[model samples]
Target: MQPPDLLFLGFFAFCAGLIDSVVGGGGLIQIPALFNALPNALPATIFGTNKIAAISGTLSAAWSYVRRVKLPWALIIPAMLAAFVMSFTGAAIVSLIPKSIMQPVVFVLLIVMAIYTFHKKEFGLLHTHLVVGRREKLLGVLSGGAIGLYDGVFGPGTGSFLIFLFIRLFSFDFLHASAASKLVNVATNAAALLYFVPTGHVLWQIALIMAVCNIMGSLTGTRLALKHGAGFVRVLFLVLLIGLIGKMGWGMLR
Candidate 1:
C-alpha cells in the first residue's frame, strides 16, 4: 500500500535538505517527522524511508558545499570507502547483536565530544589540515570505520562525531570538517541502504516525499552557511551536539 504520509513528503524533504546542509543533523528533525507521521507503519519501512530522505538531503548538501568550497579529495575518498564498507558489515550484523550494549559508551563519548567542542571556543574556525604522515591516514581510515559502524547501528549523532574528529584529529576547521563529514555520511547511508533495500524495508513513496523536502532544506541551509560562514556553523554544531546527548541518552535510559 502507498504510504498515507506521502502526501506531504515534499515538505519534509525540503526541510531535511536545508537542516542537513547547514549543520548535518537533519535526521534530528526528519526521522522523528517520519515516525510521528507514520505511526502505524512498520519500523523497518520507516528506517528505509528515513534513509532515502537522508540520502537526498546529504547529496544536495554535499553538492552545495563542493560548489562553494574546495574539498580534500585525498581524505574524503578513502574515508568514505572505509565508512561504506564498515557500515555494510554493521548492517549485516544488526539482528545478531543488541545495539543497546554500546549505547552508554557512545553516550559518554558524545558527552566528551560536545564538551571539548564547547570549551575549545576556537577549535576549528579556520582551515588547518594537520596530519600529513601515516598517522594522519590511519586516523582517517580508523575514524571512518568506527563512525560508520555507529551510523549503521544507532545513527543519531554521526554528523557531530564526524565533524569533531575532522576538526580535532585532522586539524580542520568547522567549515572544512562539515564539508568532509557530508561525504562520509553519504557513504555510511549507502552502506545501510544496500542491506535495507534487500529486506524490503524501504517505503520509496514516502521516502521520495521526504527526499524532496530534504533537498529543499539542504539548499537553503547551504545558502545560509555560505552567507554566515564558519562561526554560524559552529554555533549550530554545538547546539546539535547538545541535543544529541539528550536524545541518545534518553533512548538508552528508557
Candidate 2:
C-alpha cells in the first residue's frame, strides 16, 4: 500500500481502538476501513489483518482495566477460556456458511439489544451481582462460547454483544462489563488469529503499524472510561449500538 493509504488506515485503527476500548464496536470502524483501504486484497486476508490489529488494542485495554478495575475474575476467567476454545472452532467453520444469512440475524439482534437497553433506563448504571457460584459460571461459559463462535464467524459487534451479555446476565454495570468484555475479546481474537496466521492470511507489515496506533487509542479510551465511570460508558454503548445498527442494516439492505 502507499503511504497515504497506510496513514488513513492507521488513523481509522486509532479511532476504532479508542471506541472499542470504551464500548466494544471497534470492528464497526476498523473492518470497513480495511476493506476500503485494501480493496484488492483477499477478504480473509483483510479479516486476518484486522484481527491482528484489533488484538493489540484489546490486550492493552484489558491490561489497563485489570490494573484499575476490580473485575470478577472467578466468573470472567472461565468465560475467557470458553471463548478462546470456541473462537477457534468458529474460525475453522467460518468459510462453510454464507455470511448473507448471518448478517440479517445479527442486525435484528442488535436492534433488539439497543431497544431493550434504552427502555430499561437504569439497566447498567449500578453494579448488582445477581448470579453467583455455579450458575454464574455456567452463564459465563454459555455467553463466552456462543459469542466467541459469532466473533470467529462474523465479527462486527462481538465486543458490544459481550458487554451487554455481561451486564444482563451478571448484573454488572457498564464499566465493569466493558472491562470484562475486553478480556474475553482478547481471547477470541487470539483464537481467530491462530487459524488465520497458519493459513497465511495476515498482512503483518500493515497490521504492525495499525497495532501501534490501536494501542495508543486504547490507552486513551481506557483512561477516559475509567475517569467517567459506568454512566458514561452506558451512554457511549447506546451511541455505538445505534451506529452498529445503521451499519448492519445498510449491509443487509445492500
Which residue runs does candidate 1 get wrong by more than 4 Å? 1-9, 129-132
User: lDDT per residue, candidate 2, 54-121, as tens digits?
Assistant: 99999999999999888778899899999999999988898897998899898889999999999999
Highest lDDT among the candidates is held by which one?
2
* Residue 35 alpha-carbon offset, candidate 2, angstroms: 1.6
Please write out the lDDT profile of model 1 over residues 61-140, one tens digit for every residue. Answer: 89888887886676777789899998888877777767667777778988898888788888888886454567766778
| Top TM-score hit | 2
Model 2 lDDT at residue 74: 86
TM-score of each: 0.92, 0.96
* Sliding window of 10 residues with minimal summed lDDT for model 2: 124-133
Q: What residue pairs are clashing in model 2? A: none
